[model samples]
Structure formats: C-alpha cells, structure tokens
Target chain A: MRFLHTADWHLGRLFHARSLLEDQAHVLDQFVALVRDVRPDAVLIAGDVYDRAVPPPEAVALLDDVLARIVVDAGVPVVMIAGNHDSAHRLGFGARLMAAQGLHVAGRTGPQASCVTLHDAHGEVRIYALPYAEPAAVRDALGLDLPSHEAALQAQLAAIRATHPPGVRAVAVAHAFVVGGAVSESERPLSVGGSGAVAAEVFAGFDFVALGHLHRPQTIGERVHYSGSLLKYSLSEAEHMKSVSLVEIDGAGQVTIEPIALQPLRNLRVLQGELATLLAQGMDDARRDDYIYAVLSDTGALLDPMARLRQVYPNALAMERTVLARSGQASAAGRQLRELDTGTLFANFFREVADADLDGDQRRTLDDLLADMAAAERESA
Target chain B: MRFLHTADWHLGRLFHARSLLEDQAHVLDQFVALVRDVRPDAVLIAGDVYDRAVPPPEAVALLDDVLARIVVDAGVPVVMIAGNHDSAHRLGFGARLMAAQGLHVAGRTGPQASCVTLHDAHGEVRIYALPYAEPAAVRDALGLDLPSHEAALQAQLAAIRATHPPGVRAVAVAHAFVVGGAVSESERPLSVGGSGAVAAEVFAGFDFVALGHLHRPQTIGERVHYSGSLLKYSLSEAEHMKSVSLVEIDGAGQVTIEPIALQPLRNLRVLQGELATLLAQGMDDARRDDYIYAVLSDTGALLDPMARLRQVYPNALAMERTVLARSGQASAAGRQLRELDTGTLFANFFREVADADLDGDQRRTLDDLLADMAAAERESA
Candidate 1:
C-alpha cells in the first residue's frame, strides 16, 4: 500500500504578524501537482491542518481548493485527523457526508476512533485516524482513569487493537509528541510542564505510525514517523528541510519511506551582520523576497534599522540589536547584585548618591548598626 | 415532486447583544422533526445559512448537527446556496466532494448557475441554484453590462435557460429582494437606493421560484414564494409567522404549497406600559423566559428599569422610555424654528441668553442687518 503522509499544514498561520496564506497556497499548488504525478492510493494528513481554532476565511478557501484538487480532481482518498490547534467540531463539519466522497476527516475522538480501510493487491490495510484528545476527554469517552497522555494514547491504541482482525495489517495516524521526536518553536505545546509526551512503544503493533504536533520531521521507533510541517513557520525553524513523506508498505508490513522536498514561495532565512553590510548584500540577493529575520551586530544605537533593511529586503519580518542584548554585562550586574554584602552595598549606593565617601566615624556607626541588626535577626530566628 | 424549502437561518446571530444560538437550536430541532415527519424528496435552503461572513464555532456545530440528521439520518438530499451574508468561499468548501453524498451547495457564481437534478415518480425536476452575486461579479462572469439586480438576474436567467432542456420542469432558487416584497429592519438592504430589487417577471419562465433575502413568508406571483426565516431575528419581526414551505409539484407542473410552522423555544415578545406594571405581570407570566423588549411609558425617570425587570423577566433584552422620546415636542420645536422669522427668533434667543429683552433700538438695528442678509442671499441665488 502506497500513500503520501503530511502533517502540520498550519494554514492561516502568521509569522511576525504577517499572513502566510500566499506562501501556503504556492507550496500547496506543488503538492497538488505531486499528487497528480505520483497518484498515491491515499493521502494521510496526520493533524494540525489549521494554525488556529478559528482560522481566517482565506485559509478555509485554500484548504477547500487543495482538498478538492486532491480528492475530486486527482481521485485519491484522504484520511485526516484534528490536531490540538484545530477546533475539532468546526473542522469535522460534514465529516460523515464527506466520507462518501472518499474524504475521511476525523475531527473528534471517540471510544472507537474513525477507521478507514483501503485495499491493495496484497490485502486490506486498516488505517486508524485518531484525533488529538486531552486526557480528560479520553477518560470521559472511554470510561477510563487515564491521567496522562501516555495512558490516554495507550487506551486508544488498545481499543483499536481489540477491534482488529487477527492477521490484518494496521496503520495508526495520530497527533502527539513522541518522547524522542524533534520539536520546533512553532509547534504549540500540548500541555504545560511537558506532560503531553507519549511513548512510541504504545504504537508497537502498527505497521507504520504517522505522527504530527511536532514541526520537525524525524523517526522515533523504526516504524514511527513525523512528516513535519509544510513550510518553515518560525525563524527558529530556519534550518529545517520541510517535506512530506511518501511511504510504501509491503505485504509483509515492511515500510520504505521517501521524503519529498517542498519548495516554499518564500524561504525563511535568518541573516546576521551590520545593517550596512546586510543592506549591501541585499542589493544583489536573488532571494531578497524571502522572509528575513535580521540580527544587527553594530554597537550603540541605530536609526530605524528595520525600516532601512525593509527598503532593500522587502520581506524582512523582524530585527534585533545585538548591542542591546548584552548578555555578559547583564549577567555581571546580576552577580554583583547577588554577591555584595548589605552594609557595603548601602555604603557604595550612599557614596554614589551624595557624591562623597563615607567618613570613618560614619563607617563605624554603620558597622555598629549592622552588628545590632544581625543580633536582632538571630533573636527572631 | 415534493420538497421542503427554507432560508435565512442567520445562525450565530445576536439579538439585542444576546446570543441566539439556543433559540436557533430550539427551532431547528423542530425543523428536523418536521423533515422526519414530512419525508420530502429533497430539502432546499435558498441562502444566508449564517448571520455573518464568519459564524461562531457553535453555529458551525449546530449546522453540522442539523445537516447530519437531515441528510444522514433522515436520508434526504439537500440543495443550498450562498446568501449575501455568507462568505461564499468558506461556505462552499468541499462542495464538490459533498455533492456525491446528496448535499449540493452552490457558493460561487460562474458562467452558469449550478444545476442539481432530482427524479420523482413523474420524471426529472431540474433545480437551478444560483448563489448571491453582486452586479460586478455578474458582469465579469457573463461579460454583460449588468448595472443592477434586475439586469443581473435577467442575465443569469438567460444563461440558465440556454442550457436547460426544452420539456423538463425547472425550479429556480435565488437570494434576492423581489419587487414589492415586504422587508423588516433585520433584513439587510442588498444595495443602496434599493437597487437590489429585481422584478418578479425575471423568474416568470420557471415552474417555481424559491426566494430568500426577505424574511417575510409570502407569495408574489403564481409560482414565486418565500418561506421566510426560521425565527424572528429582530423586534420589528415580532408579529411574523415564521415557517418553512413544503411544495409538491404534479406531473403537469401544477404546484401545491404548504407552510409548515416552526415553534421557537423562547418567543420574542414586546411589552408595553410602565416598568412596574410589566414587572407585576411577570409574576403571573408562565413564559417569563421569552425574550422581552420593554417600552416603559412612565412620565418620570426610572432607576435601573432593565435591571429591575430582569429580576422577574430574566430575558429582558432592551428597554426604552417613551416619555423621554417626546416626538411631539421635538417636532413642535422643529416647526417653531423653521417657521419663525429670523428677527423674532434672534430676539427670543437674546432674551434667553442675556436674561433681558432686546431694546427698541437694538431690534431696529437687528432688523436692518436681517434685511441686508436677505438681500445678500437673493444676490447669491
């Protein structure tokens, strides 16, 4: 069974308050073309199809257009789930009706997660598409005492396993953070204090596990994979080679994965240099229209450097002054504040305020006062 | 052929700054039950499924639940179109894919309006569903000089007629204000200066024309009908008999129309009389939960009347003081200002400002100045 696996489209996302719809549309056009070229039997979108619970209208339109092209024009069945970022109910609208047209979208998690079965020359492959659900929701639906993500995921997997026929191969598509998968800044944390992580071994019996919620593509277990986001959503992801995965499963359940690179409309690039040098480089930069995050290394204050850089690199999204981010000086000041004795620090402050050193008599009086304060503290303790 | 026709749901609407989702859900529950009882061949929604371009998530969920019940549970095909208030692109998402499952939604206008054909014991009945399109969009798509609603409708009708078969019975579903249709304050004017009005004669050729955009349930020509909105959306529509239409067409194209009334959970009511009287009446009112718009007729000031009324009638939405309105006094003042001569009005104003009447010499001088001003006005004219 062959399929195209992708996740974290994050449609309607904004980088530095700039809309990414145009860039998303550009890459999705290629995605549609790839479907036409490869003609995969099914398309698996793991989750995080939108960046927000309530996305902008243009984002809805883009998703509509691309899905129509893939499902209607290309005639490929698509199985999708909802990630944490999606409003499950909103995304799942018309799910039952749309499934008749071979667009299987699992927007809400149930006791039995939505299962889409496809057949190849080898046999039948049952794909379990489980939408992202918190532990409370999972507990409510399944009537279990699942206290964490790992327990919730295990219960869901167990339910799927119980329903499986003895010899049939199964595949699971989920949106979760596996313990070993790489993450990026753009991926919203599923829980506070990192309690959202799930174990890869929970998906042991599945032939292949497709995951989302982490924006960097990686493999955790031998068969578990993250297809990553379609584009670089943040400057922290500047080094990501964003792509979708094409997976081929054999009759014996052996998997062969090929990463298909995507060309973004505007590549997210980070540049570090003095303002003048960066401006000079932009004069001949062919990819000047790329989303640029600049780090100015020049010392002292600069006059509207961001506005200046934007004149040349029209897509410069953000900038920061390295001089203002003087980590060494800040740490030194913190150390001095932490280590200084109270009386000595007060004397130093008095000298600065009065513009004169404490006299010997005043110093002795201060010392005597400090000794009395220490005795009082001892008594209170 | 029998079908249920309804429009102007206005989901996610707020009445007097209060959410109407509960009210909508209550009425729609009855609508779903009616569909189950009637068992029509198809359900037709003319337009305005939502109140705004983007409805709230709960509204989306409600629509989804209702559609699922009607299409999936009741096993009825639904034909709907976009109204002016809907974002066409957002509403039309997955339209083609959904069509395969007997849910046909026309969200965008093209060279030809969308046609969905349903069969009966008699034969094929073609429903031409035209979405709401502006004059500019109609002009651009059809390459015609459509300057108003009338012209646009004529052009769209011509396009549909050209492709329609000769002997087949046709029904046209549209969202437009037909000539002479009664309107309410809640119904947004389609255009400035009432240019959105389309002549009923434009739809003369069709066997039946299902109309929307006017929230009053009424029949225009022999075959033209509006089912009205599902519920009263404004205080001005307090007396409206909200219902959906059930139409049965015979083999010879004769039509029988039945208006099926919907019962809202909380009826919108207007109360008149003093605030204390209204509050006293609420003691014995069994329907205190109904939405209330109070008209307080007390001559003097009242203290926090709405707050006091809400203690008994919890759903009191708005209140107004009729004594403060003083329309008669305002008009009398306006008449006095308009009809009084400039010199006399000036003298009256001087008396009020200076606490004394103008002297004889001052009046004579003011009269001379007024004469000079009149002469200057005559010269300018």
Candidate 2:
C-alpha cells in the first residue's frame, strides 16, 4: 500500500499580521503537481487542514480547488482528520456525502464510524482516523476518569485496539503532541492549563502512524512520524524544514517512510548585519525576496531602519537592535509614564463603557462634567 | 412542475453586533422542514447565500449540512447563484463536482455555464441562473457600453432571450435591486457610488423570475417576484413579512405562485414606550423573548438604560432616547475639541512615521525632545 502522508497545511495563515493567502495558494499549486506525479493510491492528511476554525474565504476556495485536483484528477482517496486548531463541527460538515467520492473526512475518534478500509494490491488496509479529543469531553463520553490528555488518547486507542482484527494491517492517522517531538510557538496547546503530551508507546501496534500538530518533521518511534506543518508559521520556525512523508507498506505489514521537502514560495529567514552594508550588496536575489527578520548589529539605532531595509527586502516583517538584546537588561525603566487629559481620558472612558467610539452627545456631556467638577472644587476650596 | 424558490439567507449575519448564527440556524431548520413537507421537484435559491464575501466557520458548516439534507436526503435538486455580497470564487468552489450530486452552485452570468436543466414528470425545464454582475465586468466581457446596472442586466437578458427555444417554459433566477421594490438598510449596494437598481422590464421574457437582494416579499411585474430575506435583518425590516416563494409551472407554459411564511425562533420587533411601563407587565411573554429595538419615550436621559433594559429583555439590542430623535437638529456642533499632550502627540506622530509602536529608546528620546520643545516655546513667548 502506497500513500502520501501530509498534515498541517494551515491554509489562510497570516504571518506577522500579513496575509499569506497568495503564498499559500502558490505552495498548494505545487503540492497538487507533486500529488499528480506520485499518483499514490491514497493520501493521508493527519490534521490541521485549516489555519483556524474560521479560515478566510480565499483559503476555503484554495482548499476546495486543491481537493478536487487531488481526488478528481489524481484519483487518490484523501483520508483526513480534524486537528486541535480545527473545529470538528465545521470540518466534518459533509463527511458522509463526501466519502462516496473517496474524500474521507473524519472529525471524531471512535472504533466504529472513524475507521475506513482501502485496498491497494494487498488485501484491505484499515485506516483509523483520530481527531483531537478534549479531555473533559472524552471523560464524560466514556464515563472514565481521564483527567489528562494522554489518558483520553490512551482510552481511544485501547477501544480501537480491542476492535482490531488479527493479521490485518492498519494505518493510524492522529494529531497530538507526542513525546520527544520539538514544539514551536505556533502550535496551540492541546489541553488548557495542563500537561498535554502523550507517550509514543501507545502507537506501537499500528503498522504506520501518520502524525500532525508539530511543525518540525521528525520520527517519534519506529513506523511513527510527524509530517509537520506544510509551511513555517512562526519566526522561531525559520530554521524548521517543512516536509511531507510518503509511506509504502508491503503485504506482510512492513513499512518504509520517505520525507519529501516542499520548496516555499517565500523562505523565512533571520538576517543580522549593519544596515548600510546589508543594503549595499550583502544578500542574494532569493534572499531579497524572502520574508526577513532583521537584527541590526549597529551600536546606535538608525532612523527608520525598517523603511530603509524594505528597500533591500520588500518582505521585511520585523526588525530589532542586537545591541539592545546583548545589554541583558530589561528596558521597561526607560518607558514614559502615561498622563491623562479630561477630553481624551473621557473619550477613552466612554469607549470602555459603551464598547464603541464616543458620539457627539457623550463627548459634550463629558466636557461639561469635567468643567463643572473643576468649578465645584474651586467653590469648595 | 413544482419548485421551492428562496433567497437572501444572509447566513452568519451580525445584527447590532450580535452573531445571528443561532437565529439563522433555527430559521433554516424550519426551512428544511418546509422543503421536506412540500417535497418539491427542485429548489431554486436565487442569491445572497452568505452574509459576507467570506462567512464565519459556523455559517459554512450550517450551509453545508442544510444543502446536503435538501439534496441528498430530501432527494431534490438545488440550483443557486452568487449575489453581490458573496465572493464568486468562494461560493462556487466545487460547482462541477457538487453539480454531479444534484447541487448546482453557479457564480457567473455567462450564456454557456449558468443554465441548469432539471427533469420532472411533465418534461425538461430550463432554469437559468444570473448572478450579480459588475458593470465593468459585463462591459468588458460582452464588449458593450454597459454604463449602468439596468443596462448590464438588459444585455444579459437579451443574450438569454436570443438563445431561448420555442414552446418551453423557462425560469430566470436573479439577484438585483429591481425598480419599485422596497429597499432596506441591510442589503449592500451592488454598484460603487451610484444607483444599482435595474428596471423590471429586463426580466420580461421568463415565465418566472425568482429574485433576491430586497428584503421585502413583493412582485415587480407579472412574472418577477422577490422572496425577500429569511429573517428580519434591520430595524426598518422589522415590519416586513419574510417568506419563501413556491412556484408551480405546467407543460403549457402557465405559472402560479404562492408565498409561505417562515416561523422564526426569535422575532425582531420595535417597541416605543416609557421604559418603566414597558418593563412592568405591559409586554407579553413572547415579546419579552424577542430581539427588541427599544425607543425609549422617556423625556429624561436615564443612566445605563441599556443595561437595565437587558434585565427584563435578554435580547434587547438597541436603545435610544426619544428626546434625541425629537430635537429636530444635528448635534455635531456640541462636541469637545481634542487637546493633545506632548507624549501622546509625539507617540502618534512617531507611529505614523515608523508604521509601528515605539520601543524604550524611542520613547525616552521623544520625551526629551518634547521637553526641549516646550522649554523653547516658553522661552520664545
């Protein structure tokens, strides 16, 4: 059985408050081309199909196009699950109807409804899709004392394992924070205010485990892998190499995995140097077009450094002075103290009260109130 | 042949800063129930399926479920088009693939792709879908001088009229502000900075014209009708009766229309009376449960009136003083002139200059510069 295992597309992601819709669309176009070339029997997208529960329309449109190009054009069955960042209700809208067209979307983790069987020259290979499970929801559902993320996941796996038929190969698709996987700022915590990591040992029985939720591609155990996010979503992830995993399993249940790196439309990089030299002739044409985080090495802060740097790199997102970083002291002491004015302060106060902008009547009333209070204070004194 | 004609769902609408997803869901639940009970041959959704170009996730999920229930479970065909409030690319994402499943989503008004044919016991009936068109797009595509909304619509109708065959009944589904139709604040302008209403005579050739974009159920001509919105969107539309149009056509090119009212989960109403009297046993239980627009007849302005009103009516959305309405003059002159401090003014200017917020060093520098400027001004005076 051959399958292209990928996850964490994070479509419609905004980087540093800038829209990445066009860049994401470009990468997905290449991804469709790659899927067409491989022509895998099935595609396993572990989780985090969208950047958020409510993605921008452009992102939804892009996903619609790419899914068609894969399921209709490449003739590959797409088996996907909802991740922590995804809303299960929103993602699982047309699961039953779409399954008829070979687009299997699983939003809940269970033994019965979530397992889909596919055949690829080997007998039937059962694919189990486990979406993100909240601990409280799972605890109430199974009437178990599952106080942690690992316990909830373990319970789900145990149910699947109990129903597993002997001698039939199974591929497990899941989204979780597995032990020993590197974390990034972009991944939302699976559990709120608690330990959310699950041990890798629970996935040992599956022939191949396709995982998501971590942006760095790595293997947790034998036959278990994290395909990572398709694109780098955070500045700390600048050094992370994004890739998709392709798994090939033999009839005897042996598995082999290959990591295929995707070329980003615009690479994310951190550039450090003096502003003048950097602008003169320091970087290549490719670096000039990349999304840049500039760390200026100059001892004195230059005037409007970001504006000057944008002349060299149009996509410069953020900048900072390295000298300040090396000072090793917090700069809060040098900040200005806030002072209030009656008119401005009243506007802010009314804004808080009304939860909106101050209208003409409210502003005039505030002005009169301030004037009256001053006069009353004079009279009292 | 009988068909269910509806439009202007405006799913995901935000009324008075409140999410209407729950109200919309309730109305659609009844809408689906209506479709099931009627068991029409086909369904015609003219336009404005979404509240905005990109809808929230919950709205998309709701539409997905309802469309599947109507198309797959109810065993009926649905032909819909995009409106001015929708993004064509987003709404028509899976047009061809969905059409195969008996759900036709049309996004453009061209001659070739906009027509859908449905078969009934009588014979085959042609349903032409006309999505909202920008004058510039229509002019460029047709190579004509389409300077107005009516002109563009006239050209499209003329093209369809030329292609029409004899002795067969046809229905044209459109989204436009037809002449003499009552307007509402909720419907967005179809054109930029000008009149967007088209004449009703443009749709004269069709046996039935299912229309949308006006939130009032009314007839524009012999065969043209507006189904209105499914729910009351604005305060002005609180008195408007909302319904879905049901049309029956025979093989002899004859047509009959009927309006079916929808029962909302929560009704929207405008109430004007003394706040104390209105809250003290004057209104019925049903009105208390409604979305109320309170125009207080109290002569004196009450403090925190909205907060107090919400105690009685949980969904009290808007409140205004009758004195403000009776003043008979604008109140912009009674406003306070803003006086700026050195720090805030400097920070605002610097934000404009750098297109970002100030850090520690910039703040200290601005404070020093402002002090120096103040001293200089005092010395000069």
Candidate 3:
C-alpha cells in the first residue's frame, strides 16, 4: 500500500521571535500539491502538529484549513497524533467527531495503545498511535514504575505489541528524543540532562516507525525516520533540507522510504561580516518576498544596524550586532557559567547594578525578573 | 416557520477571569435540545459568534462541534454574521466554502444587504444579510462621505431594495446597538455614549429587523427586536431572562414576532446579605448549580470575603464587600473625580504611597508606570 509518512509540522512556530506562519503555509502548500500529484492511499502525520501546547488562533485556523484541504476535499484519510509540544487533552478534544470524517487523531495516552486499522485491496494494516508519553503518566497509565524516558517508552511499546492481533502488517508512530539519532541544533532541549533520549529498540516489533520532536529529516536505522518540520523554525536549522517521507509497504510488510523535496518560502541565510562589507556585497540571492535575518560582525559601532541591513535586505526579520573572534581572557568557570543557569548570571548582574545585598525579597524579585527575561529571550531567539 | 433568532454568542467568553468554555458548551447543548424539539425552519444568529477576534483552540473546537451538530447533522440552515467584536477578515476566511453546506456566514459590510433566498413549499423568502458596519467603513464601502451609522445602514437597505427584484417576502438581519432598546448591562459597552446607537428608521423598509449586540431580548417597536445573548457574560445581567426571538414572515411580507423560551443552563443569581447570615442560611437550590455573584454587607471587616462566600455559594463568580451607603456628598466634584483619568488616579495613589513630591522626572516615571499598568489591566480584563 502506498502511503505518505510526514510529521512535526509545528504549525505556529516562531523563529527568532518572528512568526513562521507564512513560511509554514508556503511549505504546506507544497505538501498539498504533492498530495494532488502523488495520490497516496493514506497520509500519516506522526506528531507535533503544533509548535506550542497553546497555539494562537491564527495557527489553529491555518491547521484547520490544511486538514480540510487534505482529508475533506482531497478524499484522503489522515492519521495524526499529539506530540510533546501538544496538550494531549486539547488535541484529543474532538477526535471522535473527526474520526467520522476519516481523519484519525489520537492524542490520549491511555493504558491500552490506540490503533487505527485500515484495509485496502492489498491487505489490512494496523497503525499503532503512541503519542508522546511522560514518564509519570506512563507509570500511572500502564501500572508500571517507569522511572526513565527510555523505560517508559519501552513499556508503552511493549503493551502495544502484546495487544496486537496476529498476521497484521503493523506500523507505529511516536514523538521522542531518541538516543543515537541526529539531533538538530534548532530542536529545543526536550528534557534536562539528556533524559529525553529514548532508545530505538523500544519499537522493535513495528515494521516501520515514524517519529517526530527532532526537526531534522533523517533515518535512525532502516525502519525509523524523522520527517522534519515543514519550514526552518530557527537559524540553527538553516542548513537542513526540510522534506517529507513517502513510505510504501507491501502486503508482506516490506517497506520502502522515498524522500520528497519541500519548497521553502525563502532560503534562510545567516551572513556574518563587517557591516560595510556585507552591504557592499549585497544580497543578490535573497528572495524579495521572503523573510530574512541578518547578523553584522562590526567591532566598531554602527549608527543604525537595522536601517543599514534594510537597505540591502528590506524584508529582514531581525538584525544583531556581534563581534566575531574578539580577544577574550576567560577562565573555565566563566566558560561554564555561559552553559549554566542564565538566571544566576542575571541575578549577579542585577546585584551589581543595585549594589544591594541579596535579601530574601530582593532575591525572589531578581529570580522572577531573570526567569521572565530568559523566557522572553527563548521566545525571541 | 418556528425558528429561533439568537445572536452575540461570544462562545469563548471569559467571565470574572475564568474561561466559560464549559459553561458555553452546556448552554449550547441546551440550545441544541431546543432545536431538536422545536425543529425550526432555520437558525438565525445575528453576529458576534466569538467573544474575541481571535478565539482559543478549545473555543474553536467547541464552536466547530456545535456548528456541525446544528447545520450538518441536524439538517438545519444557519444564517450568521460578523459583529463588531469579530475580525471580519478572519471570520470570513472559509465563509464561501461553508456556504455550500448551508452555513451562511456574512462577515463583510460591503456588498451591502445581500440576501440568501430560501425556498420552501409555501413560497420563496429573501433573508437579507447586513453584517455590522462601522460608520467610516460603511461610508467608504458604499461611496458616501461621513455618513452616520443610521444613514450608512439605510444606504445598505436602500441598495437591497433597489436590486432585490421584488415578489419575494424579505427579512433583514443586522448587528448593532439600536437606540431606545433595553440593553442588558452584561453587554460590553460597544461604544462610549452615542457612537454605537443606530436610529430605528434604518430598518423602515424591511418586514423584520433581527438585531444583535444588546444582550437583552426586547422589541424596539412592532418589527424590530434584539434576540440577546445566549448566556450572561457579566453579573450586571443577573436578572436578564435570555431567550431567542421567532419571527414569521408571510407571503405579503407581514411579520409576526414570537418569543421562544430558552432553557438556561443555570439561573444567574446575585445575593445580598451579611457573610454570617448567608453562611447560616445554606440555601440549597438547584440554581446553586448556576453562577452566583454575592455582595456581603460585612461592615465589621470580616477577613477574606471571597473565602467566606465560597462556603455558602461555592460557584460564586465574584464577591464585593459593601460598606454602609454613605449620604450624598460632593455631588459634582466627586462624580468628576470618579471619572478622573485612570493615569492621574494611579499617579496620585503612587505619590501618596511613596510619600514623595512629584518632580518632573518622578512624574515621567509615574506616567510610564501608569501606562504600563493600564495596558496590562486592559489585556487581563
């Protein structure tokens, strides 16, 4: 049976504090065009349909439009799941109703693994939907003490395997930060101390595994693959070629994965050079209609970097001034401090400015301010 | 034809700083039950289907479910418009697509007074859709200069009258705060003073004018009526008997207005008594399941009035402590002070608290703080 496997669209993503809705829509338009051309039997979106748990209204509308085009208008069945970025309850709200329209949306992490079995002329294939499961939730749902992400995922997959009926070609979908997989720099840190990594052996029973979370289109082994985000959601993802995978599974359950190219709204280029030299060179390749981000490596101050960049790249979404390879005298502690808590660094900076001792009230206020700043920075970055 | 005309649903309304999605769903379920029993020819919603211009995902899902039930499954035609509260552009996104499914969503003010002509065994009837129009927009759209709200509306009706082709009975649907209609206090002030008031003469040519915006079911004259909101969004509307209006138009365009009884999810009650007395009474009415707003007359300064009220009315949406009514003093000046700019009031309050003279620098700082506070309050509120 011919089916397209794609996931982690992350519809409402913000790259460097600028909305990527237009870029996402551009890529999604390509996907829809592909559906028209390829005419796959079914489309499977593994997980992370949204970038944030609580997406804005525009994001919801975009998603609604895309889904309507694919499943409702195009006469295709779509199977989707909620990823770590989604609120399971929120995503699962109208699953029952949507199922009636031939769109299977599974977001609930119940003890018994939910599966959508579709039958075509070839044979019957069982599609196991395993949404991102928290370790605590997995323990509670499965009645097992799964103290680690790997153990919890393994247990959940094991349950799905145990409940499966015999002689059915099975495929599984999941969202996790798996071990020994290519991690994109733009991907958010899923869990602290790398506890987010789940071993790939967890899905040993499934013939094919479609995964999300890491925004890089790559295969872990012959069976598992990540169909990265539709658009570049961060500068760190600029180098990655975003695409969806088309998998064809025979009646005997043999699978073949085909990479489909995605069209970006614009190529995201990060050029770091002296402000004057960069402007002199000009951005000949930058699409006039595309969003851009520019970085200037000017040791000396420029009057207005934004104004200067806009002359060359009028659609520049952001501009930053950073001096590259500056002479620095730093201890190991200073280097480590850069990697450590930003909150502590901010608190120290504030203490110096205020010239006050860290009293309980001041400390609390500083902590709150630093946290808010960090959150804002993360959102903007 | 037994039809219910209701409007200003504001489906995702947040009341008393709490999400009313669950409450809205409950009330909508009741509305569906009414539809099932009444089995109206059509369901007419005047405008303001969503509370905010941009509704949350849950709200979108809830509205989707309700619309599907009413239009697709129930086989009822729904005629709706975009109110002043709505973003016309966003709401009109899929209007053309949904129109095929008998869900007529009118979101634009221009193409003034377009009719969705419905046919039945009796005869054909023209259902004119006149979405809410700001005076400025109406002027620009209809090629007028500085037209009043009433005049602009009349222009729309005139256009409809000129091009309607005659022979069919017509019913007009609108969204505006009409002058002299009893507006429920729960309805957010559409405009300050006279800006929102539309003259009754605008609907002079139509057989019936089904209006929205005012959250009270009341008739302006023989043919003009406001169908009110489905649920109370504020404690100010505690006494409103919310209902839909059923209008029957004959072959000759003769109209008859009928009030349809609405099954309210719960009665909104406001109780006034001392904290001790309310607690002692322990009133056990099914209406307790409804939302409550309490006014505690505790002059003795009881601590935590909200905490105390929750003991008696657990669902109390708000609590205001009422001291003894003071005799009339400083009538004009006091009223002026009450109307003082919020910025000035904050400045005064801060000055008193800090015990500092208002220097130029201090005043500037205070102004910035007040502006920030006002913005925050507007957002939160």
Relative to the true structure, how large is the alpha-carbon lDDT of every model? Answer: 0.86, 0.78, 0.73
Off-target runs (Cα >4 Å) in candidate 2 are A16-18, A87-89, A107-113, A137-145, A234-239, A269-381, B14-23, B53-57, B87-90, B93-96, B107-113, B133-146, B155-168, B184-192, B234-241, B266-381
Question: For model 1, what is the alpha-carbon lDDT of residue A197?
Answer: 91
lDDT of 2 by residue, B212-305 (tens): 8988888876688898898999877889888898889888767888999988878998878888877875355555878988878898868788
Residue by residue across A118-213, what tens digits does model 2's lDDT show? 887779899988887676556766778886789888888888889899889988999999888988767865643334799998887889889989
Per-residue lDDT tens digits for candidate 1, residues B234-263, read: 777888999999999898899999998888
In terms of docking quality, model 1 is acceptable
Tens digits of per-residue lDDT for model 3, B1-381: 445799988977887787788878887887887777777778888888888666666676787778778877887878888887766645654454566577777876775655687866668777888887666667878887644567778778888888876676677889987889875545654433234577887777676778889888888888888888888866657788877777777666776887766666656788888878776765755455667777666778678877767766677777665563332334334434554455566667777998876777876776567545533433232
Tens digit of per-residue lDDT, candidate 3, span A52-89: 76666577668777877887788787888888777665
After superposition of all CA atoms, the RMSD between model 1 and the true structure is: 13.2
Worst 10 residues of 3 chain A by lDDT: A324-333
**Chain B TM (all candidates):** 0.85, 0.83, 0.82
CA shift of B352, model 1, Å:
21
Relative to the true structure, candidate 1 reaches a TM of 0.80
Ranking of all predicted structures according to DockQ, beginning with the best and ending with the worst: 1, 2, 3
Per-prediction interface RMSD?
15.3, 15.9, 7.6
Candidate 1, superposed: residue stretches over 4 Å from native: A143-146, A193-195, A272-288, A295-314, A318-381, B193-195, B271-289, B294-381
DockQ of each two-chain model: 0.32, 0.17, 0.13
